[model samples]
Target chain A: MIRLENVTKVYEGGTIAANDVSLDIPKGEFMFLVGPSGSGKSTLIRLMLRDEPVTRGKIWVAGKDITTLPKWKIPYLRRSVGTVFQDYKLLPNKTVAENVGFALEVLGRPRSVIAPQVAQVLELVGLADKAKRYPRQLSGGEQQRVSVARAFVNRPPIMLCDEPTGNLDPKTSVGIMRLLDRINRTGTTIVMATHDHAIVDAMQRRVIALDEGKVMRDDALGTYEGLGEEE
Target chain B: MSRILFLIREAFVSLRRNLLIVAGAILAVFISLTLAFGALVVNEILRINTLAWQQGVHVIAFLNDAGENGVPSNAHEVLLEDVRGWDEVDQARYVSKAEAWIEYQELFAGQEELLDIDPTILPASIRIELVDIALHNSVKFRLDQQTQVVRQVTTAADSIEQLQNLSRVLNVLGLGLAVALGLSAIVLIANTIRLAIYARREEVAIMKLVGASNWFIRVPVLLEGMIEGVAGATLAVFTVWLGSTSLARAGEGFALFRLDVGQDWFLSWGLLFLAFGAVAGIVGSLMGLSRYLRDADGTGPDTPAGF
Candidate 1:
């Protein structure tokens, strides 16, 4: 339930991050944005979150035009759209439970409400036993799981990820993909930008490739790179 | 409300996390405010003593005994009666030749040559008290011009004038010093808050990303600044009180000036200092939060490193 029509993002130093790009994804679709560096993959995610303003186009998420949304309304936009980063941006000092519960806490949810939701998400991500452990105390995969739990704690309908498994081993990446797949099975839409060919090929989900700020390919059940494109 | 309690708890948690930085901020406020309050107290001390001295004698006019300006020998009595009727004059009395001679002998009893001088040589003075001490110059000029009824005049006006000038200068300089120091303390506090925020920047980034409002992030940091400021103010007020009390106690044996200002005066100022401390802390917190809040909007320095 996200639509971007002729959206473009231009940086100050004359770098066009997203150049007249357009896309539409129906509800409950798990899609991968496959692109090389500087191909506007992250820019698409940022524009969806309204973290960066679109230079010349409209973006609608969940039937509302987010490009016209005021600055103060951006937080509410973010609440409906969960975000995850490659580095697993968890507060190092907080335990896994606190980090996960932080999602609801920022929403001004009461402790009674936040506690159960955080526990459920941690269980879903398979980190139920390590709730008390700090981020540094957990492995790379565990830390990424904690980040995933934080993103999913509020039970948002849409999850946007920028390389969710970039820093993890292949086996860890599989675990993360399985967790994402489980979440997707619950009818939540997921758009992930990635550089991982093996992961994308194995999942065989919808793939959209971009190059030089323009969409190159959009396919259902697509591989990371079609048989001929080597790089 | 639970909201307020949550903010307070969060603020205290941050202060505890950065104990060293918090201490530095409080110490800065303390030192600056101490100097500020100290200057105010010193100026007040001088004012109280000046009031005590001014109450003693307003103006004393020494009359001529020779009557050289066509004045009668009995002019001392006439001058005293005339001064008593003047609007400026509060009370006036004639000191006769015999009284003047006796006062002369009591003053020079240890001097052989001064004791042998003739009694008529000493002037029979008409001591004139004024309605207000500030009217000294007007009365002095009037008496000095009274050549027909009086020959000469003397007053304690010069000393009082000097003291008033000194107090005026001190008032300006003291306040200037206080304002400058207060500003520096504000800057120091802003820097301290910045340091605290920097240490927890990742937490801030996570909070922003997870849909925390900017105000939600700002409340606790503002509270921390306020705590540090109030702590500094308490130390400053106590130190000023101790200093003034000790100075007043030491001046007990010295009868020339009264050092103790009543507690009411100090009590009000102490409360004011505390309020000032709280405001300064808030101002500093706002200053420190400017960049951080701007960054939280989107692409800040703390943005996560990623693809």
Candidate 2:
């Protein structure tokens, strides 16, 4: 679960990324953040991750206030929250299994423990047979799947997705969305920021719309466009 | 622990992957440390030679002449006893005409032309070794005050001073060169670590996101830099030892009595160089990591460089 109390983020050039945003996201809920570019969606995700300090107010993730957390504690916070980027930030030199295993390995997990977990995650992502292949050898969809496996390998309580399917084809994006939906059904909270109107409308999930660094709408079971809009 | 082993393995793999850059860093350390080792050896050699010259005959007072039967006169013997009794004089040996002749021959053994002179023509002198080279002036004054049986008083003070001054300048020059070169070695190491960091920036970013501590990312790079330093220091020590002994043997003591830096002396200096190389490697790593680590820690610009 996550809570933001009037969180505000202002960049160096007098540009406000998030303006007095307040929201509550419960556990096991799938939410889509629909907005145009520079609409504070990515900034909100960053604040939750503690990537940058909140310029104002506080943020609570997984029942802890993170706005005042020290920089040294940021990594520990990241361990409990999985993140997937649009670019599938995989190490090009690493194999699919190693990429998945990296999440556990970096946290100082034992090799014996990591091997089985990596295998299970790869199977979940339907890439068990391609474990030995490097990132460049995988297709766009498969690469994103590998990234998804990496993020989900540790099975954190919450997953933050920032345009994960932005680069994938529509059919592949649906498959990836389905995988995320399965993850969310397993009682893991997911907050996906995206511009994919079709996917957002199809999911029929809770939706928050932002414009000009402020939340414009919050709807339960909302369409890609808000409830007041004419399709 | 397995974690330490894992870090060390990472370091080794990185070094192997960047073989050329690692070698470059090692070579930098090697060249700098070699010069530093050579400077230390040269300083020791100079100290030994200077001490020998100062401790050798600091003053020589010549007697009036030889007796009719190739023996120093009794008055000359009395003068020798007087000089020996002086507090400034450590030991005054009465060199007879025959002893002087023999010393002259030994000094120029291979020079047949210089040894062709008559034995009696060599001056019979009193060779005075002083407790300190500075006491030479007092002894010279005492000899000069006496007119009997003292033809001339020659003090080796000026030549000793010259040698001391030359040694001081050479010591400073060698050490200065070593220091400048040592700094260059540190900079080269810093650059090498920077390149290594650049090559793995993406991996570093992922590692940070996955909750890897800052040290988990830093220690392996630090070890890699340190290994380069140690490797260079090893080569420097071996080369310095080899070069020193070879030069000493080649010179055949080089017309000096104090080419006598022993193995123990060289070993101690070599150990110092090794320690210095390790410290320098660490300093270079710190220098290289400062900017990147700061950026990674969220203290930099709007865009995060990497963790």
Candidate 3:
């Protein structure tokens, strides 16, 4: 459901963030983006979200050619793709339910419709009892679960995860990974950018490795270190 | 409609989140609008006093003691008749020397030494109240041209003119002060809204990422500004009404002029102030949002790192 044909993003000072990148992900596939810092992984996700304009080439997300899309329509593009951040961006003042319901609220859903959907998502994240608690009152793992609940609330066709488990501990990271895996199994394509080598090596998903603004490897079922590597 | 309610709720929540800034905005609106309302009342009072002054005898044409026949001769009668027929004259009353003498005695009733003065020295005159104060000079010139019967034509026109000039100056000064205060209020409101938006930057980012309409985010800020403005304006109107009512009830106690600003006048002006406050609040919030929250293309700002 995602396609990029030679998309290049150059920064203000001529720093090439993503150069001549061409890739495609079929529907319902789970992919891992393994890279070091400044490896164009975040830039690729941003391009898909239309957060930044591409310098050249085309991008199609959910059947729309977003590269030539007007600025006003960027919000529509974003609505079709769910995003989970590394830091679990939840409003500290909002309860866990409020945080999850925020997605539907922004969609202008009626109160009667939003309440049940929010409750269902909170239950899915196993935070039904913690719905009334604030972000600061929740553990880091629980906070990330709230973030996952929010991203999955609308059940969009694709999910873009940018180091969602970057701040979580190993055990918590595995739980988040499992939760994302379960979400992916429901026919939602997931593209997650990460530096977690152990999680990537264990999952053995379709891996796309990037280094210095270019894709270095594309493996159908690859570990974090890529295929044919000694353990 | 429910979406609008949601936006309004968000606005209140944001307002509660930054209570100090909201209070600052409300206070600014109140102070500025109060000054404006006071200036309006003062201007209205000046106008009323000027009208009252204009309603009195504005010009007096004194008859010469050595007229053609006698004191009430043909010359004096003709002059009086001509003045009464003039379009400018609303009413003209002939004051005889005897009547003038009696009036002088009543004016200085406590002064025994001034009562001994001869009554013949007091000239008989026709006191004229004009239809309009602007015709003072023209009416005076008409009497002066009748030099045979009219000895001197005196008028309070110069004093009236000076008072009118003072009123104009005061009006200009009040307008200038009101405009300056209004601009400052706008600036203060913008600052307050800026703080509010900054505090909710994370929420704004999330809303943007979730594909919420720009207006959905902006309406709350705009409503917050308008709320402050309307609240301030209401307080100002109430304060002015209270002060005016008290002054009118204590009428004539302090040897001052009448408090003639009626309730209808106050009501109209109060409505105007409220409308101005609401407009100012909306503009201030829009400015603040444009400056800090939205980009040049009217898109939301870059999402900050939020957790």
Specify the highest-DockQ model's number.
2
Model 3 alpha-carbon drift over 4 Å, by segment:
A226-231, B64-69, B73-78, B109-120, B132-134, B145-148, B244-259, B295-307
lDDT string, candidate 2, A1-231, tens digits: 999999888887778888999999999999988788777788888788887788899899999999888878888899899999888989787789988987887777888889999999999999999999999999999999998999899999999998889899999999999999999998999999988888999999999998767889999998777433311
| CAPRI accuracy category, model 1 | acceptable
- What is the i-RMS of every prediction? 3.4, 3.7, 4.6
Error of 1 at B84 (Å): 3.8
Instruction: Say which prediction, candidate 1 or candidate 2, comes out ahead on DockQ.
Output: 2
Shift in Å, residue A14, candidate 2: 1.5
Off by over 4 Å in 1: A227-231, B53-56, B63-81, B90-134, B145-151, B299-307
Candidates ranked by TM-score, best first? 2, 3, 1
DockQ of 1: 0.43
lDDT of 1 by residue, A156-202 (tens): 99999998998999999999999999989988999999879999999
lDDT of 3 by residue, A25-88 (tens): 9999999987887787888887888777788989999888999999678777777788988878
10 residues in a row with least lDDT, candidate 3 chain A: A222-231
Colliding pairs, model 3: none
Tens digits of lDDT, candidate 2, B171-198: 8987787788778778877887777677
Tens digits of per-residue lDDT, candidate 3, B98-199, equal: 899999999899999999888899988899999888899999988888777788999998898898899889889878877787777788778777777777
- Model 3, clash count? 0
Worst 10 residues of 1 chain A by lDDT: A222-231
